[model samples]
Target: MQHKNTIKLLFLAGITMLLASCANDDDTAFTPMEFTTPTYETNLELLLGDTLKLNQEILNLPENVQFKWTTEDTVLSILQNLEYIPKQAKTFALTFKATTNLDSISRTYQVKVNDPYDVYYRPKSSESSSLISQVLAYNPAPGQFINSSFGTPEDAQKLVGSTTNTISLGAWGGSILVGFDHTIENVADAKDFLVYGNAFNGLSEPGIVQVSFDTNGNGLADDTFYELRGSAHADAATLTNYTTTYTNPGMHADVPWLDSLNTAGSVVVNSYHPQNFYPLFITELEEVSYTGTRVFPVVSNSGFTNIAALEWGYVDNYDADYATYKGNLLDIDQAIDADGNSVNLRGIDFIRIYTGAQVNAGALGELSTEIRGIADFSMLE
Candidate 1:
């Protein structure tokens, strides 16, 4: 009996010790680890020639954990999962996988590519396969000077429309145009732009009128000029007074002696000034012919009656920033004379019509005012 009891006790002790060893083994563990993907925000839904960044944060892993990266076949790459770039574009499926210590996690990212000048050209018209197409509408560069080239940031904010007017007094069947260049550096789209021009031509009226740049930016009559008689006379320097008249087939762009002042085939833009030295030049052609005092009546909400057609005319002819005049044309048709003949349209382009006419509602006619902007068409090729 004693031997049996001793044997039984030895067996029980062996079982207890085995259980304790197993529990101790269970408590022994490898190093703990954790992982989390990085997070960031993109300023745009679509990216073009721009760059994107991926920000990540790691956690609870061995300080010496190894990192292996893989990416898609694309124009640009982060080479690692942190930042992947889709150089060109695609409705792409992209994935990123991270593996460490036998534990792996993955994520995906997507973005679209688009033109920055979308406001002016979206779903492009047949007229423009490029990023931007022709933009119409312009304002005289405040104090526009002659023989000089200059631009403003306001000139880059293009104007968009489904269609343009088929009729006008200046340039007919308006076809918008613009060019861009900058004087300073450090721009968002360096390939963006700096200068701008807008123009249109009306058939038989204002045949051609275009905004051009001299490019020197000095506000002096420098680069582009008209050779009149012999000397290269800059177009305009002051804005106090200005006039435009077409010259006959007489002058060329370079020669001056043969320059035609009248009865020729070139345009003469004359300007008056007091403080400025550079005159602004605008290319034009012949269109409408006129003789008798061409009257323009102005009408506006302000109840003024005896206003004359002048820029700095009446005291109450003021509004937000500048004075504007609009008129009801009692007559502006293709005039036929007493002989049943098209009043032989003589002057068919921009002409120096006297501005001393009477205003309708007031004395000066009502003017149409709008926020002027320019659109570039280089991308529409």
Candidate 2:
């Protein structure tokens, strides 16, 4: 009986020790794998091309925990090191998974990518698209340049529904100031807007486009201007920081234009538009000065050269020459000051396009850049 009692006590002690060991294991094992998110916010809004850095330490996960990042859409590209780059302009949901040997937790991040630019205004200019009624509807604003020669200066708005009466930027400095109802945000990989001009055949009258932003919010186009440097901006022959002045000779007299290069040219009398292609709206000013880059026309043995079509980032070039060009589409990111310094513009509210080249298209007299309409690419997409 004694031996049996001793054996029973040994068994009980063994059971008690086993229970204590199990309790100790429960206390030291993994603290139920609780996770506390960091105080920093995860949701963010960023412009396209901006870098996005995520803080992995905020997950409050274990030291050995592994992170897996994924995006719901292809708009954002995620790197293995938790950095991200936006590829498109749109809102996206990004998910981060924090996983350990036994527990896992996930957090979704809301990211908004703003669209670059929207079609703000399309001025009534000469367009050769053969679709007048359809093109007029794309006109964004009612404000048009007035000409007293047509009728009452105020009544003489841009020819609505009429393709014959196109706005003429006569010579070297002839320009039309176009504005956007809203500012156009600059985004990465975005082509911003298009300048639809009546360019065809051997006539690719290129224009130097300029942009401005509404800085003071007073809603006027009196802000500083930046030139939209085209592919020719870096060429040795291209002129930077150029200026031209056009002086009216009145009625039948030709408008005399002189450039900074001392090259004298006249807004000659073209027989096609005998009514005077020089804009008759602003009769108050005898002379006007325009400052911007000068784009030379394609030179050939015949004096008129058909330049190769740029893939993108230009307007009114020989588009039909190459299969790549759809029209004169321009990107806002290509903006630069007169000194060839890049302007980091977030958005722009106004655009001005002027007749850039001073070439004589044989019977056409002096080649003038003619704009038909403008469209924002973001809206089309």
Candidate 3:
């Protein structure tokens, strides 16, 4: 019996030892690897042709931790530090992993690489023309001048390389795209360019202006165009995504139109200038559609129909006679994206002007924006 008790006591002692060993093992279990840095930026921006360095010291990681960086399908680096040079302007998503014997941690970073501000900048020289070098596009809405003096693409081209020549961007939503021989720099607290228009004291046909830069170095205006925020941009009555579709009357008569707001109207033909109001250049389509911001015109029909101009920040608004006669001095600082958010542009390569009003004055005529010329303000004396 004493021998049996001894055996049981030994078995109990073995069980206690096993429990202690299990507790100790739980206390010393490995923890997941983590970054020691208090705060780190996950999004970064850099210019193309610039070096981006990632240091392990910033992570405050352990020396024994293994590091790996990968992007897309390829591994970029396996060292503790990574040095990257981007050859193209784009956004890169990089995944970084740190591993230990028992655990691993990973993080993803988005890096945006932009082209240098001056990469597409064309400096002014003796051969640089102050006026626009080319007319990239011309699409005029239905108006008195649609088939008369200013509807053809050639008429729009006449404004190119000359400041004295003018082209009427027919009624609402008519637009013309023009480019410069050199980039127009956005000087500090100064106007960058001028849009010439025939705005007088009582007559103001406002035009919305947009600008774009050749980010791809392709020398084309295929890049995104940012609108220049005018004073009326924030007005309660202003329609941001206004669209108008004009159905070809197919003859020399009033051009019928419908808008996004379910409103219908016509570009009334005046007896003074009688011609087809529909654009002759737009022969391919039975209906031409234009979408843009529309500003309500303040018209008074006392003895004569008169349209009042907004305060400022438009192409053809009557502000001062001197500035009106010369051209509308435009500042690049007023650029805004489609969401009406302000955009900071270093410079611009292309300029677009479009008619912003859709009012039909009694006998005076439909309000239309006109472009005489475009010039770099910095290049002028």
For TM-score, the strongest prediction is: 3
lDDT tens per residue, model 1, 202-320: 00011111222222334322322110010001113211112223222222221111111232222222233122211122233222222212223232345543322222211111211
Candidate 2 regions exceeding 4 Å error are 1-166, 276-278, 283-285, 301-312, 320-326
| Cα misplacement distance, residue 83 of candidate 2 (Å) | 39
**Of 2 and 3, which scores higher on TM-score?**
3
Cα RMSD of all models vs. native, in order, equals 24.5, 14.6, 9.0
The superposed Cα distance between candidate 3 and the true structure at residue 42, in angstroms, equals 20
lDDT of 2: 0.58
TM-score of 3: 0.74
The CA lDDT at 61 in model 2 is 47
lDDT of 2 by residue, 158-192 (tens): 43333344454545555666654445656577777
Determine which window of 10 residues in candidate 2 has minimal summed lDDT.
135-144
As a whole number from 0 to 100, the lDDT of residue 215 in candidate 3 is 67
Give every collision pair in model 2: 147-281
**TM-score of structure candidate 2:** 0.54
TM-score for predicted model 1 compared with the true structure: 0.27
1 or 2, greater by TM-score: 2
The 10-residue segment of model 3 with minimum total lDDT is: 55-64
Runs of candidate 3 with Cα error greater than 4 angstroms are: 1-112, 321-325
